[model samples]
Structures are given as structure tokens and as C-alpha cells.
Target: MLWFPTLSKSGFRSFIADNDEGSTGKWMVPIPVPDIGLIWEEIEDAAVEGRILAAKKSTHELVRIIGHNLACVYCSASDPDTVAETLRTLREIGVDGELKYKSDLATFDGREEYLYSSSEFETLLPRP
Candidate 1:
């Protein structure tokens, strides 16, 4: 199973794009994770740069550190209670933001599809 870290649009683009640091330091580029096992090491590496920290610490500490910029979408592969724990921790820390779940729409024949489920969808779609 793969887990995608939910980040802001800019952060997501930055995470996927290649960058060069000019002549000051070596260019640090993000690499795609081919396997889930590499996630921990990658998180540790990012933590060193202060981008994010591992959640091995207390929930309170982790919540305080994560703040309100974004909340990681608890992956389906994680324990069922993981999302609840994260939400509880976030609430305890008084953080503002939503904990989202991964979802998709697909046809029975395996074709991928995208459809708006919100009330805005009705307003946006042309009336037949």
C-alpha cells in the first residue's frame, strides 16, 4: 500500500519537481518513493531539514509541531484508529484544518472518472 502525504498545492508541486541550488550547495531533488519501506528514512531526512518530523514523540508534541499548515491524510493502510488519534491530537492542540480521506470515482469497467459531489456541482453543470 502507498501513502501520499497531503500538502498544500505549492508544497505538493515542490515535492515533485526538481530544483537546483545554484553554486552554493548541491542540488537536492525529491525522488519518488518506489516502496513504502523508504518512507521512514525519507521522513527522517526531511526532519533533519525541518520540513517535517517523525511522529514517534508524544501526540501532543507531534500536534504542536505539525501546527495548522496541513494535516496528513491518514492512509487506508494505517490502523483504523490512526485517523481518530490524529484528529484528537489536532483538536487538543487547537489546530485548524481538515483531516481528509483518500477517495476516487471509477466506472465499473475500470475507467477513471471525476465528478463533483458538492452542491456547487449542480450550479456548475449545464441543465439538460
Candidate 2:
């Protein structure tokens, strides 16, 4: 995997134009959106159907990712059990949400996968 500190459409074009498929099995372009978290009100006390809706609403982005890539987003109030339920529910509805302990990443397309980073010191660079 090639992690670019910054990328642009032209940069992506340059990447695709490169002739080094042997070096990089796949390329991943990360798009990080800030200040967005899935909040589920009364998810624990809700019924199965309610939890389904809660899970779907909370993890809707997992299914909507475009292209061959993954996404790492934050979900508020995501306990282990809740996260498990969300993953299960997402699978039931034909979506994929994975849980990496000491981690936080999810992939929609099957091409490239990125594990959630467990780093405290991180930076988000601009991309276009």
C-alpha cells in the first residue's frame, strides 16, 4: 500500500501512469472527513428492528464508498457489543463494517484494504 501525505487528481493520474505494479500491489487514496460521527440514540434499549435501523443509519457510509478504496470514520457511542451488532446488522443488509482492535478502518470495495491506525499523533493532509 502507498500512503500519500497529499494527493490530487493529477497526482492520482501520475500514480496510474507509473509502471510499478510489482512494487505496489494496490494503491489507496484516503479521503478523511472530519467532525462526523454516527450517533445512535437508545440503540441499546431498542428492539431488533430499531437496532437494524440504527445500525443501518449509523453505518450507511460503509456501503456508499465509490471506487476501489476503504474509509476510516468515527462512530460515537461505539462499544464492543454495539460495534459487533452494527457489523452484524451491516452484513445482514449487504454492507461490510469491520472492527480492528486497537484500530479503526473499513473498506467497501474489494481492491485495497487499510487497517485503522492506532497512532495518537496523526495528520490529515489536503487532497483534490
Candidate 3:
């Protein structure tokens, strides 16, 4: 059930297309990142703050990869050779768990907050 951060386009598409039912649901890929991995949450917060919600590309990719693999262990099925490269590509595109920012006030349309720098995420976020 451990899931990796990135996979190829074909890999991604194949993952989500899988169909099945059992102890593992169709999209039951548990995020393997540490500490509940605030990546997705942070991304949502970033989008809402900027008032420009981003399409859930990475999330969908994960669904796809898991679906295609038809197994919760999508990350395990990943080819280690390409894992690093794919992660690099994702990072470059701001799709790699990076709460990407854009400077377009027209899109901002009011809802905006100070950007969440890496150093500020833990502090800025309310403790549960």
C-alpha cells in the first residue's frame, strides 16, 4: 500500500484504469511519505490561498498508477532506474509535492496569504 511520489505517463494512466474490490479499494494507495506527509494538504492550502485551484494532476496520477498496477503496492512496482528521473521532472514542473506559487494577481482575486516557505510550513500550520 506504500505509494511513491512520481511515475511515468503510461505508468500513471495504467494505474488508475485498474478495477477491483477487496481489502484494498481501487485507489487505496497509502501515501508513503513521512509524518502524514502534508504535501497534498499543503498543495490544497496553496491553491486556495492563491484563489487559483490547480487541477489534481499528481493525485490523479497516483490513482492511475495504483489502478493500473491493480495493486496497492504501486511504488514497489516502480522501476527504480527511472524513479529518480521522474521525481526530478515532477519537481521541475512544481508537480512534485511542492506548493508551487504563481504571480498573477488577476487570478488571485482577493484570497491570498504570505507564501509558505519551507521553513514556515510547520509554524504557519496550526498544530492539531
Candidate 4:
């Protein structure tokens, strides 16, 4: 899933609540955006195209359009080829950023669950 650094902790929690289907076994695979920031126009365009692809190719909804920076894609039941195509389009538009991954704990349903960490996500700098 694509996650914007600007999202507050509450906002992030809200996103999880909205997207999760009460599945305790789920993991948050957050792909962070680096400090260079994204090309918003390109991202918006890609999201529209992705939505179109999801409509024809996915059994479940894939694209979640919040804004240029807040969009998320739920790829659980989507076609890999379509996801690849969307990624390729991002690369073609020079929308590149380093993705960070970390594991942390969160509470869901009164039970502790593992969630990929997003600490310092907004401070990520481009690799030198």
C-alpha cells in the first residue's frame, strides 16, 4: 500500500480501520515516500489509470483515491500484471523514492498485532 508521510497517526489509524475487514492476520505493507516528494500531477494521472485497470482486472476494489499524496491501493485480490503495469507507469514518469520497512506492534481487537513501522517516514532522505 502507498502511504504518505504527511498522514497523522490518527489518519493512519483511520485508514487501517477503513481498509481492514476485521482481519487480525493482516499486515500493513507501507511503501514510504522519500524527501524529494512525488510529482503530484503524475501521481494523480497514474491513480486514474490504475483505477481504470482495477475496474476491469480486479475482483475487489484496488485503488483508493484520497489525494495525490494520500492514495492507497489494496492489492490483496488484484492481478499481479495490473499492479506491475501501474508500477511500470510510475517508473516511466520518474516517480522514484526509497521504500522503508520496519516491524512494530499495534493493537487490534484488544490483541497485539504486528504492523510495518512508519517511524520517521517523513524524514527519509534520498540515498546519496
- The sequence of per-residue lDDT tens digits that candidate 3 reaches over residues 2-115 is 343432222222221121111111111133334254544543343334322121323445556654321111111223222233233223333323332212221133435322
Ranking by TM-score: 4, 2, 1, 3
All candidates: TM-score? 0.23, 0.24, 0.22, 0.31
Cα error, candidate 4, residue 121 (Å): 22
Summarize candidate 1's per-residue lDDT along 33-104 as a digit string, tens digits: 332334334433443443432222123334345431222322122222333343343333333332332221
Candidate 2 has a TM-score of 0.24
Candidate 4 per-residue lDDT, tens place, 30-70, comes to: 22243255454445454455431211111112323421222
Error of 2 at 60 (Å): 19
Candidate 2 colliding pairs? none
lDDT of 2 at 36: 29
A best-first ranking of the candidates according to their lDDT comes to 4, 3, 1, 2
Better of 1 and 4 by TM-score: 4
RMSD of 1: 18.6
Best by lDDT: 4
Give the range of the ten consecutive residues with the poorest summed lDDT in model 4: 52-61
